[model samples]
Structure formats: C-alpha cells, structure tokens
Target chain A: MERLGSGGREGARRIGEVLTWDPLVRLTHWSVALLVLLNGAVLEDEGQPHVWVGYAVLGLVAARFLWGLVGPARARFTSFPPSLSAARLHVDEVMHGRERRHESHNPLGALMAYNLWATLLAICATGLMMESVAFFGVEWVEEAHEALFAWLMISVGLHVSGVILESFLSGRNLVRAMVGSFHKRSGGGA
Target chain B: MKLAPFALALAFAASPVIAQEVAQGDKIGTEIGAIASALSERGYEVRKTEREDGKVEVYAVREGRRFEIYVDPETGAVTRVKEKH
Candidate 1:
C-alpha cells in the first residue's frame, strides 16, 4: 500500500497527481465556510452584512446544487449518491482495516454533504420567510430558523471531525483536497 | 471574566417597580394579553410572544419595521428592542 502523505515528497517520488476538486467546488466550499463563520460568530446579526452574508450563502448552496448536476465527474451528485448500505460497508471496512480511500468522497462524507445542503436550505427558507411581509414577526418561523441554525452548527462540527478522522485514517490531507489539490497513487489503486 | 457575572446579574436584575407590577408567585409575570396590549399601545402590531429567558420575547411590527422586543415579564417594560437589519 502506498503510504499516505507520500505526495509530500514530490522530487523523490511522484505517485498520482489528480485535480480532484474543481474551481467551483473549492470556491463554494471556502466561500460558504467564511460566510457562515462571519454571520454565526464574528459579525453582528443586526448589521446589513449579516443579511447579505445569508443571501450569499443561499446563492452558494443553490449554485452548488446546480453544479452537482452538470459539473465535473467528482462534483456530480452521481459520484456519491447517499446509500445506507454503502455507508454500512464503509463502516465495516473501517472496522476491519480494509477501508479504501475514495478518490472524491466517502459514503459518510456524501451523506454529510447532502445533509448540510438540506439543512442550509431550511435555514435560508425560514430566514427569507421571516423577512416577508406576511411572515414578519412570526414566532414559529424565527424559532424554526434558530433551530435549523443549531442543526447547522452541529453538522459543521460533524463535518470537521469527519475530515480530521478521515485524514488520519487515509493518511491524505482532506483539507488540501477541498482546496483543489490531493495526492493519489497513479494507476495503482482504483 | 469577572465582569461576566456582573453583566449577567445586571441583565437579570428586576427593579422594585417591576416586582410591584405583577404578583410574585406567578411565573411569566404579566399575562400575554397584557404584554400584547402594552406593545400595541406603543404602535407595535404584536405578531407572537413567547416566554424566554425570564422575559416575554415579543415579535412585532411597527410602521412596517419588524422588531424583537424583550419585555420584562413583571413590569411589562420593553427591556430591549432588536430591529431587523
């Protein structure tokens, strides 16, 4: 088995150089991350920037969903359809020391992707509803938005933990992958 | 860190007037209807009200501006008003 992080030694050995993350994938990922952090923690919610950031996050989610249909091989939703059996198998492999590193995303990662997108959509929808004339001052809508935000925070925690765990197990820096670069054993393991 | 407790205490401090405004035994001091009436008197169209953090968090609109007014349950005073951005 090729050692994970062997890609760090570019001169001594070149394994497989693949562009796993497309520009849009990397862009949307970081953009959403920054916007969420800004709105959720750094920025004041009463400021105009907070609303604009929410709108930007909504736009990014919409674009990402659309890209999942027409984007590159790795970006397409077909690349990692959510499957319980597949996730179970991945879990089993992890337990048995037979888990193979995925070229794009593992089963659990795909589930998290779908979950984050859906949760964000819910948060944005409620947020937008709260701003509408009819729904303005509606308690349930605000409560729902708040509840979804809490879920989003939980999802974020899971995502970070999953990334860290996968990186350790696969020996590949997943963070580097999301930023448009990753190392793989060329023509060796599919 | 020391200021945190002070701030928390300040936030929850109830004035003497507030204690006299509502009964001591009753939680959520003033009735929701009374809170709504008080908000309406101030030009707010009360949309919804919930008991939160020992206060009545009223969601209301006034002259088309939405506001989240946290009212003291006992005194029915608008402790804080957060307008939508």
Candidate 2:
C-alpha cells in the first residue's frame, strides 16, 4: 500500500492551512449567538425556558468578555484595531467596487463587530432594567430595547452580506473558514 | 359537623391576613436566599435581602441592592429583577 500519512503523490504539505479556533471561544461564540437569537425571536411567550436562556446568554457574554482579554491571537481585540479612518476608507472602497481581501475581518467588518457587541451589551442592560419596577412598564426603556434589537438585526444582516461579498471578492469560502478554521494560504494581505 | 362551618368561616376571615404575612415573609426570605446564592455563585457578595408591600416588594441586596428580584415560588421563576434601583 502507498504511504498514507503525510506522504503521497500530492506531497506531505496540505494546500490550505488550519488555525482552529479555541474550543472554548468557538463554543461560547456559537452558543451565545444561538441563545441571543432564541431570546430575541422565540422567547416572547414569557416561558421558563426563555428566562433560563437569557441567563445562559448573559453568562456566555460575561465569559466571552473575559476570554477576549486572554484568548488566542486572532481572538484578541488587539488583533483588530478600531480605526474610524480605516473603516471610512474601507467603506469608500466598497462603495466604489474596489474592496480588498482580508484574512480576518476588514475594517468595515470590524466596525460591525464592534456595533454588534455594543448593541448586545445594551440589550442585556436594558433587558435587566426592564425587570425592575422603576423601569418596568416604562415606555422609553422598552422602546430603547426594541430599537436596539432592530438595529442589531440590521447590523446582523449587513454583516452576513459583507461575509458573502468578501467570500466572492477574496475567492475564498469565508463561511467554511469560520466553521472549519481554515483559510487559503494568502501572502498576508488581509 | 356543626362546628365545621364556623371554623371554616373564621379561618376564611383570618386567612387573608395570615396568608399575606406568610407570603410577604416567604417572599423576602426566599428572594434573599435565592438572589444571594445566585450572585455569590457568580462571584458577588450579597449583603442583605428585604421585602416591602408595594407595587414591587421583594429585593436582594448585594453591595447596594444589586438585584430586586420578583419571584413566583409556585413556578420557581424570577418574574423580574431591578438591577438598577
């Protein structure tokens, strides 16, 4: 039999590279996303599971916040600096149909990530406030929370669109990279 | 028996006040314990818990009333919490 382990006609080196996400980070990210979505969408029935899911989401966010301080290189916030000028330039490029390939999130995408997290934190805060007598049944607090939800939904839509656009533009399967933690070997452009 | 109605009526008459007292006490104690435990488990040091008869009654104190939890013991679910005030 031909050698099967790292020795074949195609050679030992794989075409693509893998930089798998830390298991905890990936678990927290996906689980938090699911919980937040469920809490926003399906938990309007005022059920026990809904409350529990909210608690779970809160816990996940807290953990992820801590992890961001001491996680993998790619997972760290320092890896993606928040630059308004950079973001504006990227937006201008996108509008002009001249976007660049990014192995990680582009400047615009990073801004979206920032918006998503900020809005999510606001949602959690307003949600907790709504539980109190002072804020409960208060129209403004409720409205604020609802408005944040709408904004978050829009941001999420745009984020997904950006992903699809980038995938095609970069000629790489971004979704697959997110799931499998593999990226096409680029010359460090993104 | 003949005395059963009298006793029942007496109990019914007094039951409201007694139930109110018991419910208020239970709400305070349980709310405090539950909130304290929950917070402590999540690394918060609870200071106290209290109950008052108002639009909102039950509350838990951690540092400075960190959580004002309204609970329905029947279902064991926190109806709400006043994390702000």
Candidate 3:
C-alpha cells in the first residue's frame, strides 16, 4: 500500500513491500490449497491417495491453528480476531473510500479464514468416519462428506475472488505477498 | 471450480445405476434378509447388505475382523470376501 501516493490511485493509500505472512503461514496456505484441489477434484475419492491427502490436510490445518495461538505477532489469532461488527464496519469504510491498514487479516478475511478451517476439519472428520466399519457404506456419512466437500468448493471460489478484489482495491498484489516473505509496502488490508 | 459441482452431480447420478445392475445367476432375487442370514451362517455378523456392481455386498464382522462379503444376488453364493483395513 506504500505505492498508493506515487501510483496516483485515489482512495488507494498503501505502498511498498512489507513482511506480512510468515513462512509457515505461506507454506501451509499453499500446501493446503494444493491438497484441497487434489482431494476435491483430481484424485479418485474411493482411492487410497484421497484418504492420505485428507489426513495431510487435517495435519496441516491443525498445525496452522496452533501457529495462530503461539506464532509471530502478525500470525497470531489476536491480530485478526473474527468479528461480524468489525467486518461490517470494514465494509462501510470501504464503501466510503476510507482505506485503513490492518497488521494482519482484515475482519472479513478473518471470518472467512476461520470458516475455511472449520469446514475443512469437518470434511476430514466425515472422511475418516467413512473408513470405519460402522460407517462403511453408510448413507448419511457419505452424504455428509459430499455435502461438506461441495461447501468447501464454494468457499474456495469466494476466497480467490476476495483476494483478487482486495488486491485491486488496495493496489497491491496480495498474491505476491502470500507467495513470499515480502509484500508491497502500501496501505491495504488483506 | 465449476467442475467440482458438475463432477459431484455426476457421481450422485451414477450411483443409482449400480443399484439397478445387481442381477446375478438366474435373475431370481435374493432378498437382503436372506443374504444377511446366509452370511450369518458363515459366522459373519452382518452389519449392512447393499447391492453394488451386480453383487450383494454384505458388510460383516467375523472374530472382530471387518469384511466385505460379495454374494451372487440370485444364488446367494459367496463369490468374494475382502478384509477391510
């Protein structure tokens, strides 16, 4: 967001690269992204690979949640507490062209991130249950797994769109920030 | 992104076809209860019996070992037994 002044984009006040997401954050983010895609679309659901991928996803998510509790200042859950009121205020601020800086995830992003994690965990739980003798070929268990997966797919679409929209509004490549240690030094909220 | 839902729909649509295809031996129907009893006689505690891919799959446990016992729907003959991990 540091480039907002030089870029001459009105209401875009942030500029230059600043350290945002930590290495673990970026690693888990992308890894989960790939694994979700593989398990959701690429791999055969009945195949062993899909089950393994689900386990990997659950482990990564658990690690990420732990990091949120005991990680760096910016990566902690306190930095981006999920709150509906704050998210609503953020929307109002955006609509009024009043850009604000957030040290971590913006309120809306925080809520979505939490949603993604919770939904992912539920998906894994259902998947694991299906492998047991009790739930094997159980109608409701299978139905729940598929339904949760569909919800995950929808959440992923919203996530990508939100990233693009936030990047455009802030005049910074959020993608670049998540990809590496540095982000453009600018006044923008992820 | 779009393909996920499409694929999911396709999966749901394809399952009923498998349910319709279980016609083994002489096309004489072997009821679910009959299959369960047949498997129970083999010391298998039957949990579920479902028609899949032209066979009646009986999910059972024998001596605490989980198994999938595939039976010919017509003759109720044990065709395959797979131990699940």
Candidate 4:
C-alpha cells in the first residue's frame, strides 16, 4: 500500500511528488461532495434535481464499493479494516504523543470512511423509499433520510478536522495530497 | 467594485428565497379527524394529517395513486393536490 502512491521514485510528479488518492478515489470523493452540497444546500429538497443528485451519490458510492474490492491496494477495504481496538489504539497513541504516521488511512480515518459510506447508503435507501408509492408520504422514512443527511454532514466535518489534525501531527499536507498526486513524506510507523 | 448588476443577478438566481407567511387565526376545521373526514369525502383513504404552516397536509390514497392534499384549516378548502409518484 505504501508503494501504491508513487510506484517508483521516477514516476510522474504533476503537482508535487506523492499520490495518496487514486483517480477513482478522488473522483468519487469530490463527486459525492458536490452532489451532497447541491442537494442539501442549493437544490430544492423535493425537486427532481435533488432526486437525481441523490441517485448520483448512490451510484458513486456503489462504484466506490466495487473499487474497494478490485482497485489499488490503498483503496481496498482490507487496507484499513474497521476495528474498534485499532481505533482505540490510535486514539491512545495520539494522546500519548507517540502516534505513528500511516501512509494510507489511519485507524480513526478508516472508521470515519466506513461510517460515511454506510450513512450515505442508508440515506440513499431512505430516499428511494420515499420515492416509492408504497412508502410515499411515509414520515419515518423521510425523517430517517433527514437524520442520515445530518450524520453525513457531521462525519464530513469530523473527517476534515481529523485530516487537518493529522497533517499537523505528521507534517504532511493531506489536502494537497488529495488535490494532486503526492503527499509529503514524513517519518513515522503505521 | 463594478460588478453590482452581475452580483444582484446571481443573488436572485441563487435565491432559495421564497417566503410565505400564513395567518394563524383560530382554525375552524383543523383537527386531524376533520381533515381525514374531509379527505374521505373525496374518495380517499386518509393515512395521515400533518399541520404544516397554516394548512393541513393530508396524505391519502385513492385506488392505487397516493395524493398529498394541502387544505386550508380555516376554510376546509383543498388548496392544492399533489400526486405522489
């Protein structure tokens, strides 16, 4: 997974020198972000555009699920399996000031990633239910969709905060890494 | 500095800015049962009635199609009927 970024020292270096997010990962990430923002803030909630955007988000998530299985080593779910113990250990290490820098996603980040994906799936499901004739005007389903959307927003805020915190701790520009092709190298263990 | 016209245009274009103010007087027929009965008279099986703004939104079904009827609570008049697809 560590080698998944650069391949070798002599590969492409468009923006910087490291590649943390692959094309599929970056595409899905930004697409989901834009679609969610459009649906939540810009478009009318019950409008056709909002429904289409929701479907697009669901499609992006579905594609990401497949990519997690057959994509690069860094993008795979196995690379950062959700583990409560691992997340606790990461938090403990952070508290003790002995946290090791992970080249891929850290434990807490992995959990957040899984949380966002699952929450998005739930939101999409509820949204679809609301569209169906059987579930039309179903108050609980609409409420569940609204609740999941709130959770997604909260997860996004936490994810960005964690990224900034990790960047400071590990001396890596994660935002830049996501934008371009390279993450600044920092000496730490996974 | 000189982009006031463009900015105003953009603001209106991006306006999520429709505001409707409903008068909240003593409603004559605002009860859920009353709304359900009113909808039942229209050949609808009333499932739920929710008070939204100054209107009662009745979710009802007739045959197979679902309908959302917005009714004036004071007048008991159906303001709008939206078929839920």
Candidate 5:
C-alpha cells in the first residue's frame, strides 16, 4: 500500500482495468438515449407522445445535471471539465504512447458530453416553443427543430464512435461499466 | 426507468400518424376533396386532405378536437375515424 503512494497514477489503476459509473449516472445516460430514439426516429413529430417524450428527456437530463453537481467523484463535473487544449494534449499523449487512464471521462469525451446536453436542451426549448399556438406550424420553428434533431443524430453517432474507439484503445468494456459497474480488471466475463 | 408513460400512450393518433404516411399527387385530389366536403357537412372543419396508402385522409377539427377521417377511395365511404388523444 505504501509502495502505491510513491508509484503515482500507475498504482491508482492497472492498465485495462474498468472504471465504474454511479447507478444514477447509468440510469440517466441510458434513459436519455432511449427517449432520443423514440422522439427522434420512432414517434410522430406533432403529437402528444412526442411532446411527452421530450418532457421525459428533459427530466432525465435535469436529473443527470443535478447528479453531476452532488454525485460521486467520477460523475462530478469537476472531474472532467470541458477543455479543447486538454483534449489536444490528451491526443498528443495517446499518440506518443503515454496513455493515461482517467477516473472520469477523457477530455474529448467531456467535450462531447457537454455538447450533447446543450444540444438536447436547445432541442427541448424549441420543442416546447413549437407546442405553443403561436409557434405551431411556423415554418422556421419546425425547420430549426428538424435541423437540430439532425445535428443531434450526428453528434450521437460521434459519441458512440468515441466510446468504441476509447474502449478499443483502453481494452475496457465501458458499456459494462456503464450498465453494471462491473470492474473486474480483465480476468473474465463478457 | 419505466417507459410506461410512453407505452401507455395507446393508438394515441394515426391513419398511422400510428397507421402510415401520405403523399401529395393530383390523381387523389378529387377523392380527398369529396371526403373533405363530407367531413365539413358533419361539422368538422377540414384542415387538409391527402392520399395515404390509397385512402383519402382528411384532417379536421370540431369542438376543439382534431380528427383523422379515413375514406375509402373506391367506395367513397368512411372507413375509420380517429381522434388525437
């Protein structure tokens, strides 16, 4: 135990070791994803179901945002503030074969996280606006809503790709960590 | 964690807005117009009419409730009436 203190970050976690997510964190993350699928692709644009689904998404995001403030260490915003220069440095570190495992999201992942949430809020705002009689059937509002949804889909694709790429590089099953918080450090289980 | 609220949604709207989609083509205009007039006579203020899967779909409102009136193109008979809930 004393040897680990002097050994720095290497002693903090072994390579290929899985980091876990808080249960609330996992709940909010997956719920938002599913709701996005329903509202964005499955449901009709101007209907009660779509409106309610949007509200559900906003609620989940709000829960996640609050969790970010008072949740566990890893889920906290302080653990991974969004920063492009830090992300650039992270890329450099990876390129130089000096990959450093992070307890929270990697810098680039943080940027994506923030972008996704902000985009969702924007979508929610516009969606709520559309529900008003003044904005209902307005061409610009509808177009903006559709365009934002398109952008969100593109960001979602990128977020999934980022997760896959990071998992491949780190040799850790992040989806498992997210779903079950099973951190067994590479011995077995799929 | 329950999508129960969503699943609880039930037909909720469609000719399928849960049933299919409509496309604008001049050929179906007469049938749609006839359906619209019939709906108008029934106290429904017809909003729009289109051809959806070979049926005349007339969207209308009456007493603040919106409805989807599906008319058979061949028979010119009302087949289904759905309300937005």
Candidate 6:
C-alpha cells in the first residue's frame, strides 16, 4: 500500500492522504451543479428544448434529494449536519486567521452547501408549478422563481470563493481533489 | 317631426358600434372559456378573463398560485408559466 504521508513526518500524516469520495456522491454533486447552471442559463428561452431541459433538471434534483439520505459517508446529510454555533466559530476562526483545515466541508462551507441544495429544490418546484394551467400567467409565481435563481447565483459565487480561500489557507488545491479524487496533502479534511 | 329624423339617424349610427362590441365580446368569452376548461382538465384553475383591445386577457391560479401559467387567446396555446414573485 502507498504510504499515507510524505517522509513519515508528523504533519505529513495528514499531508498526502487520499480519501476517495464514492461514485454516487461525486455523481450527485456534479449533476446538481450542471442542472442548476442549465436551469439558470438555458431553460428560460422559448423553445421545446428549454422545456425538456427543465424537466431533466427536475428529475436530477429529485434524485439528489433522495441520495442525500441514503448515499455514502461523505454524501449523507447525517455526515455533515449544519450547526449554527459551529459555523459561527468557523467564521471567527477565519476572521482571526486561525481556521483549521478540514478533510471534508468546514462548518461554514457546509451551510453554503445546504443552502444551495435547498434553493435548487425550491426553484425546481416553482418552475414545475408554472407549467400548470392554474398557475400559468400568475405574476407572483414567476417572480418568486426568478428571485430564487438570483439567490442561487449569489450562493454559488460565495461557495467558489470559499473553496479558493481554503485551498490557499491549507496549501492544497481543493478543486483538483474534487476532480481527481486525490489530494497532494495527507490530511483528509475532504 | 324634427325629433324623429334625429332619432332615426342616431339609431343607425349606433347599431354597428353596438353590434361590433357584442360580437367581439362573444368571441373572446367563448374562446377564453374553452381554453380555461381545457387547462382545467389538465389541472389548472382560471382566475380571471377580460377582452382587451384585440386580445383576450386571462389570469389563472395553480398550485395555490405558486406559479402562474399564461395562454395566448388567439391560438389557445401556453404563452408561459412563471413562479409568483
């Protein structure tokens, strides 16, 4: 087996450690991301293709919601339940420049992930409702859906910024780990 | 008498205008009602309908108004459905 860390150093114990995310978890994460982006950018157009894409996004969201409960370790909601106090403390750590690197999501990052999923669900529900005749042409429903899209974009931007900041702070390329399923550092903060 | 001539002219002039309005109203009402029923069969409730200049205006409530679906009166096809703001 490959040694978990470099040079058998103490700090190296957490460095160069590789913990793989299960295939289901990875698929759910990327599918949700792509669907959200598609719904926001391309589905608003007046065409049959747009409607089909909207339906596909709805299906993807439904699948991901179910997976959150039954999926593997890192993907399970139980694995990373949100805690307000923990998030606040994490925020403080960031401010004080003493935040610890996490193998998985940090408290603040967990909160963002939760919000992103919830917002996507809301958007999908509202979008589906709009297609029904009773709700069709209702101004408020349309407006609510659009508003959720705006919020989703903001949350995604914040999430990206957090990932970049963490990568620098921890001295590892977090984005690369997400793609390649391995990190240069041994610490498996995910 | 002078009054008889004026009354006759007035009735003639007003007849076409009144007939046109009624015809337009009937067409809009029938078309909108049919469309609303079709949508209702597909699970939608029509909330309001109006005949404006040359188009029929329809408003509907679906899923407790979480979203609104709009339809074109002329073709009785869906225009768009959007979430309520």
* Candidate 4 lDDT score at position A35: 90
Classify candidate 6 by CAPRI docking class: incorrect
lDDT of 2 by residue, A1-190 (tens): 1212442121112224323345565678688778878988877623557666766877887786776677655666776667899899987887888877653467887788778778888887887776654454445776798899899889889988987987676666666545543434433211
> All candidates: CA RMSD in angstroms?
14.2, 13.0, 15.1, 15.9, 13.3, 12.0
Model 1 per-residue lDDT tens digits across residues A1-190: 2345543321122233332366688789999989898989998755677778899999999899898888776788998999999999998998888898675679999999999999998988997887876798776888899899999999999999999988788776677656643443465321
How do all models score by TM-score? 0.68, 0.57, 0.74, 0.77, 0.64, 0.61
Q: What is the interface RMSD of candidate 6, in Å?
A: 5.0
Candidate 6's C-alpha runs over 4 A off are: A1-20, A181-190, B1-85
Q: Which candidate is the best by TM-score?
A: 4
lDDT of 3 by residue, B1-85 (tens): 9999999999998775433322223232377887776556556677777788988887777666677777776675667777777
TM-score, candidate number 6 = 0.61
Runs of candidate 2 exceeding 4 Å displacement: A1-20, A93-103, A181-190, B1-85
List each candidate's DockQ score.
0.40, 0.05, 0.17, 0.29, 0.07, 0.19
What DockQ score does model 6 reach against the true complex?
A: 0.19
**Candidate 3 residue lDDT tens string, A1-190:** 2332343222122234433466688889999999998987899987789999999999999999999998876778888888999999998988887869666887878898999999999999999988886677666888899999899899989988988988888766777757753344445432
Give Cα distance to truth, residue B61, candidate 2, Å: 17
Using TM-score, rank the candidates from best to worst.
Answer: 4, 3, 1, 5, 6, 2
Q: Candidate 3 chain A vs. true chain A: TM-score?
A: 0.85
lDDT of 2 by residue, B1-85 (tens): 9999999999998764442211222333234466456445444344334444422334434443345456555444555655643
| Steric overlap count per candidate | 0, 0, 19, 3, 4, 39
Most accurate candidate by DockQ:
1
Model 3: DockQ against the native? 0.17
